[model samples]
Target: MPGASAPPVERHGRPRNGLRVARVVARDFDGHSETSLDPDLRVFVSDLARPYGLELREDLLRRGVGHSYGEMAEELLAQALPAGEPVDLLILAFSSPDVRPGRSAAVHLSRFCPGAPLAFAVCDQGPAAAFTALRIASDYSRSGACRRAVVLAVEQTSLHHRPAAPVVLPDRHRAVALVCEQTDGDEALVRQSSGAVADSAPAQVRSEWAALGPQAALISGPELALGPQAALSGPEPEREAGLGRDPLGPVVEAGPGQPFTGVWTQLAERLPAWRAERRPVLVADLDRRLGRLSTLALPAGVAP
Candidate 1:
């Protein structure tokens, strides 16, 4: 799991298309030990302006679940990268505050990759930061600035580290790693829309689905709790059943800590299934806190 330092950074031309998706791996840390929201902890968070003490908060923390976000990211990198193969770029996205005073999870993760790939951290946008990271990675890869970029998105319960701001909670700790390379063709694309237009988000997303065709499935992020009526409005109720089902799964919900990384983690797991069904998958993540929407549409066979 150790190698030479990352290569010196280089600049390159901008290719027209986005990155060609490669290996994808995800991990979920759920265990038997459980942590409850005690009264003293509740008192510490009594003045914040976000949803706390929600039903899912207790559900997110389980017994014996122990792993920091950086450790999870390292595990993911080990799974995504081959031995001694250095990554050209590393984009680590997470919402929690850094475990160390001056270091970030990205910095901790860089230890796993021997190369001096231009590693950086993306934050301050919540789960939507993953979309921002992808955009930067795609632009870097397309511009020929680098090759073989790895994106690691991680989220863990704030049971141990409490922040003042609101966060989305999930069933457990999770991380996702996407190994991307430079390629040109019709492939997976990520689209992010800014401004607080929550009302119009559904309609715009519906239009994107129309453009992608009927085979596209809609997976809304935890921040985006769009119902079928709000997300899809057409004559095909039966076809829209996919939207009615839990996009990521029942265990994942938007509430306490950052759940955006779990969105990618879930995508990594189910992408092959979507490809097998011969359908293009569209993921819509709305930053409910920031009124931003990040969407990704990947063509079949990108991962499979």
Candidate 2:
């Protein structure tokens, strides 16, 4: 009998709706030559705080390898929020973490916003990560979990750069934040997929659920390098030439590549057609050489 009827929606303590994006702040290694602390971070944070009527509460520096994505999220959340404040939603994005099986973002988030709804995804590019955070915030708003949600995407791309492979060097490292709220006449995006391929190694899937007035698509997979025919009809290609011998296979194989081309191409082809039908498209490549970083794709022209 317990399964017979729909549970009543909780109203007494539930989060409110119509959350609008309050603010967005981003910091990148735009002019830095090395990993030394960049002083412009304060300026960037200050700029982001202005539109939202908030100020930078703390200057927690995310450097080198001392912290993972989850730790970074925890530190930022602790500084931005006071203890016991009720949060409706939290979204964390990062390139790497201390462990694989245990997602640091979700875990650390639970500590500060105990009962708040949460969602997270990883990407190899900071912009992509920001896009993902925005979408997640929108989803939580639609679900009626919180009136406002906090979204963050941070990266240490310098870790993936190597002098020997100069072509593979990622030019920057950064973190970005956004506070989202619901608004009227705001359209939503929906994500549709058949799920992952059984034999295909893990690959990044950036699907845009909804955006302002139209839908968008951002695809980051390991298959960008493959030709159309090979990507579409070919069998799963063999793993990269040296994957078996490389110790970093786990991280190296995270983005789009030959094996993922089939799916990527399929989506790419279909997404454009969707856009032509009045949907705005925001697509980018989180190239394989960039290694793993959080990625996102937001509604075009939506002020970040």
Candidate 3:
């Protein structure tokens, strides 16, 4: 019984496309924040969370400043999207709850960004939202339906509509804006990936590592459960704050602390170094619940 194995993972991929990440910006929110939901909207929020088995903070709903996707997206609007930069599509991807459940944060955000880009949100996909956003962006770009796109992967720590679970919320409020542009460039390459499971993560990661040259590196999210497999491949990993490297390649990891945003945030932080070193980077994260895995292969060097 102890030796019983899990089901095999369904894996498939398409050939590379022109979708390249032009820029990546990650923001973390702390302390009290401004309000995006109006006072009059309090009544609308009343008991709406009941069906989901969540408890709402009545006091906060009435009059209080808390983190919100709309508000956060508003602040990131300028930085995430530059002034007068035309965007054809905007997507807000998140696993966490938004303060104003009544509002569409992505659609509202489009008003402040450049151009009348089609705006929408990708939620309830857990951490896979980032990957889904990239895939969608790629599809749009490939079909020539959109030239430029913005994918805002956001998560807030404050769950006003509290959950019964012990601690399902992220440690911090994080928003990662990925600007994707279609061009004949040698960078920001993203390949569509599907069917990721714990049983297959290590082998999948190793296969990805095998494809990269010595200079290239692979960073896996903590949730993928690659550490134990990593140990078998090489020396025990340094699992305190983050993951350590193995001999097969630069197999690093984002700590489990950040949960959803860890790997993406790490990509934002390490992109410059990797580019400067002329080494490609592959970032992988797995949704244990859905048994799905997403990998973003960012080529080395700036796009032409």
Task: Give the best candidate by lDDT.
Answer: 3
- On residues 1-304, what C-alpha lDDT tens digit does candidate 3 reach at each position? 1111122223354433456777788888776455635664455455666667676776665555457788777777688776668999899998876766567888899898888799988878777777777777766665556788999988777656556665556778888888888765543433333453556655666555445554343333211123122223334453321333434445556666566777778777766666666566677776766666566666554413
Model 1 superposed RMSD (Cα): 9.3
**Candidate 3: segments with Cα more than 4 A from true spot:** 1-17, 33-48, 52-65, 162-167, 185-196, 214-245, 301-304
lDDT of 1 by residue, 1-304 (tens): 0111122234454334456566568877664222222333333333332466323233323332334566667766777775757778899887653323334557667777858688888888866777677777877765566667888877665544344564445556778887877666535566776676566665666555545553333433222233212343335763245443433322222233335665566567665655566555566667666777776666544324
User: Which stretches of candidate 2 lie above 4 Å from their native place?
Assistant: 1-19, 27-66, 82-85, 96-103, 114-116, 124-127, 158-173, 185-304
User: 1-304, model 2: which lDDT tens digit per residue?
Assistant: 0111122234577633434434444443333232123344445545655776654434232442222445445555655454545566777655432212234456467666535655556454422344455555665565665666776655543331112323222234444455555654333232212222222212322122122223322422121112111122323354332122222211112232222122223333443333334334322223233232222232332322
**In each prediction, how many residue pairs overlap at the backbone (N, C-alpha, C within less than 3 A)?**
16, 27, 0
Q: Clash pairs of candidate 3?
A: none
Candidate numbers, best TM-score first, in rank order: 3, 1, 2
User: What's the lDDT for candidate 3?
Assistant: 0.64
> Candidate 2: deviation at residue 148, Å?
2.1
